[model samples]
Target: MAVDDFNRADSNDLGVNWTESDYSTPNSLRILNNRLRMGEANGIAHYNGTFADDQYVEATVTGMQFGDGQTGIAVRVSGSQGGFSAYAAILWPVSGRVRLYKYVSAWIVADAQVELANVPYTLLTDGVLQFSTVKIAAIGATIKVYIDSVEVISVSDNSIASGNPGLIARSSYWVELDDWTGQSLSYDITADAVTNGSITPAGVTSVVGGGSQMYAITPDSGYGIFDVLIDSVSVGAVSSYNFTNVAEAHTISATFGPLMGQRALLKIRPENCGHITINDNSPQYWFQHGDNIVIEPVPDAVYALKLYVSDFPDAALTTGEPDSLPDEFHSCIVDFACYALSMKLKKWKQAAKYYNIYVKNLTQRRKDYIDRKAEKRAIHQIPNNIKYGGTRQ
Candidate 1:
C-alpha cells in the first residue's frame, strides 16, 4: 500500500518518497496543515516507488483553486518533467466535466470527455470546502476513470506499460489534496479449520502483487491432525503449509481426530510446579492439558508423586472461596482487601489505615511461615512437554 496524507511540515520538498516536476518557473508545491498545496499550474508530483501495471491512484480533492482548470491522478507515469507517458483522469469543476487523457512526450493533446455532470462552478465556492474525488485505475489494456467513486469512463488503452502513480495539475494551483492512496490490485484468501484443530491466520487475508504467506496447523490435546485440504482438495496431513507467490484467491482447511491410546489426565496439582515424578522416576513423555497432566504409556501401578510448590492458591481467590493461606495469617488478606476497597471509595484516611495494618500483618506472616525454610539453593526441572509445547520443533 502506498499512501500519502501530506501530513508534514510546510516545505517545497515532499521528502524522499516523491519526485516533483515544474512545468512553469518556480513551481511551489508545499505541505501545509497536512495537505498538499500547489502554487503553480502544470506541475506534477509522482510517488518514488515503482507500482505494478494493474494499480489505482486516488485522492480526495478538498479544494480546487480554479474551477476552470483541470486536476487529477495519473497512473503508469514514466519519464520526467516535460515528457512523460501516463493515463490521467482529469476533472474540470467549472464545467462539471471529467475527462480521461493519455499524455506522451512533451505534448498532451488527446482528451476524451468521460462525463458531464452539469455542476456549476460557483457551487464549489459557495461555502463548501470539498467538492470532488478523482480516481484512476489501469489494469491490462483497460483504463478506468472514476469521479467521486462513480465509474464514468472505461476505455481500452495500452500505451503505457509500467511506471509510478502521481498527482498532476494543469492550469490549476492551490488545489488542496488529501487522503492520496495507491496500491496494486489484491486478491483474498480464505482459511478455515474444523473442530479439534486450527489453521493459523484462519480468515480472509488480502495479498497483493504475487505476495506469499504461510499458515500453521495445530490440533487440540489428545487429538492428531487427520487431513489438510487446500481449495477443497486434500494435501495430506501436513503440520504447516505455505503459499508462495500467490497470484489468486485460495482456501485452506484442516481436520483432526482423537489419538488411539490408553490415556489418563491427573487433575490434582500443587501450585506453581510443573515437573512430576512417579515412583521416584520421571515420566519420559507427558503433556499438560489446562491444570491436568496427561502421561503417555499410562502408569499401571499406584505410585507416590512428588513435586515442588507453595501452599498458596495457583490462581486468584474468588468470592465465597477460602484462601490457601494459613488461618493465622487470614487477617492479612482481609486487611489488604479493605485497603483496596477504601482506595476505590476514595477514602484516603481509611485506605492508609488498612494499608498500614496489611503491611504489619504481612511482615508477621512472613516471619512465621517463611523463616521455617532452610537457606539452600535448588534447581527445578522443567517438563519436556512444556519446554517445547509438547512438540519437538
Candidate 2:
C-alpha cells in the first residue's frame, strides 16, 4: 500500500532522465529524455508517466549551482485548464534557506513562505556542486513537496488542470539536469534466504526444557545467532549479520527473552550484511497481528513474503487427555483451535487440523445406543404384541 515508506534501490524501477515534449516542433519544446529543460517564459513540465491528472512527482538532483535566474522542480502540473506548484528554489542571495512558492491557475497562493535552514550543505554552490532532491505527491486538492526526505510545503489550486511535467530553467541559467533520486533507486528481491520463521501470539516456544519456560522467535534452519527477542527484550542476541547455513537459506530462531513472566510484543528487523542496510531509512510496518513487522525499501522495490507460524494461539487446545466429548460447560474450544478455524475460513494455509469434538461426541453416543439395543435382542425376541420363546420338549 504506498510502498510502506522504505524506498529500496533495485534494477527494475523508474529513474531521473525520466520526459515530455512536442516532436513536431522539436525546437519549440523538447524532452531530451525523461527530463524537461524548458526555456522562455513560464515554461512548465510534467512527470506523469501515466499521464494521469493526479499523481506525485519527486526528483533528486546532485551538484546544483547557486546564483541563477531560477532553478526548481514544478508540481500540481496539468493542462492549460488548471494547475498548482510546490517547488524549491535557490533564490539568489538566499542560499541555504529553502523557500516555497505556490499558484492556482493564474492566481498566486500564499502560505507564509516557510524555510528550513538546518542542513547547510543542502544549498547549491556557484552554478555547480548543488545537490537537492524534490518530491511532490498529490494529497487531495493539494500537492506537497518533500526536499530530500523532509516535508517542505503543500500548495492547492486548480490551474493548468492537467499537463506534462516541466523542469524549467526560467530566465538566464545553467544547471546539470541529473537523475532524480526518488525514481533512481528501485529493485525487487529475486531470492529470499529466510528459513524457518515463526511467531507465537501468547509467547515464544522453547525446544529445550528446564530453562525458565521462555518463548522464542527462531530461524531454525540457519546457524546465525538468529537474534531473538520479544518487544524490546533480547531473546537471543547474535552478534553478526550474515545468517547462513552455507548449505541452504538461513533460518532465524527466537526463544522467549528476559520477560520475567510476562508476554512481550515481537518485532523483527533484518540485519543481513548484504541484505539489510542495518541503518535503513526505509519505512517499516507491523505484522498482520501488528506484532511481527516486515520492512523493505520504499518508493523503489517491493518484496513478497509470507509469515509461517506454528503454534497459533487460538488453535492451541489444552495439553491433556482428549477433551470430553461434546463439552457442555465450556462451549469455547482452545485458543489455538479457534485461530486454526479462522485461518481455515480465510484459506490461509494447508494443514490437517479439522476436528470438531461436538460432532465426534454426537456420533459416539448414537453408536452406543444401537449397540445396547442389539445386545438385548440377541438374548430375547419380541414379535409385535407377543413374546417369542424356545420350543417346549
Candidate 3:
C-alpha cells in the first residue's frame, strides 16, 4: 500500500515520485498549501510505482467552486504520460454525473476506447463546498467506481490489465486532491454446505486484502455438526471459523450427522384396534417378536407426525371415552345428534326446536375453527425450505 497526503513544501515540481503529463510546463500541476492543485485545464499526473494487477486508487477531491468539467481517479494506468491506457472514475459537478471510462491516448472523449458505466451523483450541497472521496478499483476483469463511499459503477472489461495509480483533471483544474491512497485489492471467498447443515454467507463473498471474515455453521434439528473443511482439509467439528487478513481465494464446506440422542426410537405393540386410514390408504400393521409390533411403512428419517380428522366423530363414543375434538367443540356435536334423533322419532315440532339450537351451535363452532387456524398460522408457521412436512399446529 502507498499513501500520500501531499503535505509538502509548495513547489512547481511534484518530486521524483510523480510523473506529470507535461515536463516543459512545470507550474501546470504543483503542490500548494499542502494540497495537490491542478492549475492547467487538462492536466494529468500518475505515481511512479506500479502496484499489483488487481489494485485501487482513491483520493478526496474538493471542488473549490462549481465547474463545468470533470475530475477523477484512475487505476491500471499503463504506457507513457501521453499514450496512457487506464480506467477512470470521473465526476462531473455541473451535471451531477459519475462515469467510468477506458482511455487509450488522451483525456478527450474521442480517445476513450469504451464508456464502461455511469451513474448520477450530487457532488456538492446547496451552499457548502463539497468534498467527495472518489475510488476506482480494477480487480481481475471487473472495474468498480465509488463516490462519497457509495458504489456508482461496476463493470467487467479486460482491456487494460496492469498499470500505476493516478489522478486526472480534464478541464476541471479548480480542484484540490488530497489523501491519495493506492493498494492491491482482495479476492473472493466462496462458501458452501451440504444437507442437514448451513454456512452463513453460503456463496461467493469478497474479502479485502488485509481484512477478516467470520462464518457461523449451524445444523438442522435432530442433527449435529459432523465436520468442517477449509480448503479441503479437515478442521474438526467446529461451530464457527474466522479468516484473518484474507489475501487469496478460499473455500469452506460443512457436513452434518444425525444426533444419536435424537434418533428415532421404535417401540411398537400388537395391533388390538382396527387399522386407521390416512389419505384413503391403510398401512398394514402386525405383531412381531414377543409383544413387539412393526408397521409396514414409516419414514426412514426423523419427522413430525400430524393427524387430521373430520370435525365430528363418525360414531358416538362409548361412556368415559375421550373425543378427538376439543372440549369446546363437543357441545355442537351433541346438539346436532339430538336434532337427528328427534327427526328419526317423527316429532316435527321437537325436531325443529333441536335443529334451531344445532344451527346456532354450528355457527359459533365454525367461527372458532377459523380463529384457531389463523392463530396457528401466525405463531407456528413453517418456512418453505423445511425438511419435514406437517400442519401449522
In order, the Cα lDDT scores of the candidates are 0.62, 0.33, 0.62
Candidate 2 deviant stretches above 4 angstroms: 1-38, 51-68, 79-81, 84-96, 100-166, 169-393
Q: Candidate 3 at residue 114, lDDT?
A: 66
Query: TM-score ranking from best to worst?
Result: 1, 3, 2
Give candidate 1's TM-score.
0.49
Question: Which whole-number lDDT from 0 to 100 does residue 95 have in model 1?
Answer: 53
Q: Per-residue lDDT tens digits of candidate 3, residues 1-393? A: 778888989987778887767523444576888887666546567788746677899988854457756567788876655677788877766667788888776544445546788787777677354556889988778899877777778899988877888776666435567899988787788888879979998898887665678999888865666678999998866778999767579999998766533322123221121122223344522223123222222212222222222133232223442335556656766765565444333234564566456444544554455356633211111111112211111
Model 3 per-residue lDDT at 391: 15
CA displacement after TM-score superposition, residue 171 of candidate 2 (Å) = 6.1
RMSD of each: 21.7, 22.8, 18.0
Give the higher-TM-score candidate: 2 or 3. Answer: 3
Per-residue lDDT over 87-174 for candidate 2, one digit per residue giving the tens place of the 0 to 100 score: 3333322355444444344311123223322233345445454445666554335555666777766565443344334443344443
Worst 10 residues of 1 by lDDT: 380-389
* TM-score versus the correct structure, for each prediction: 0.49, 0.32, 0.49
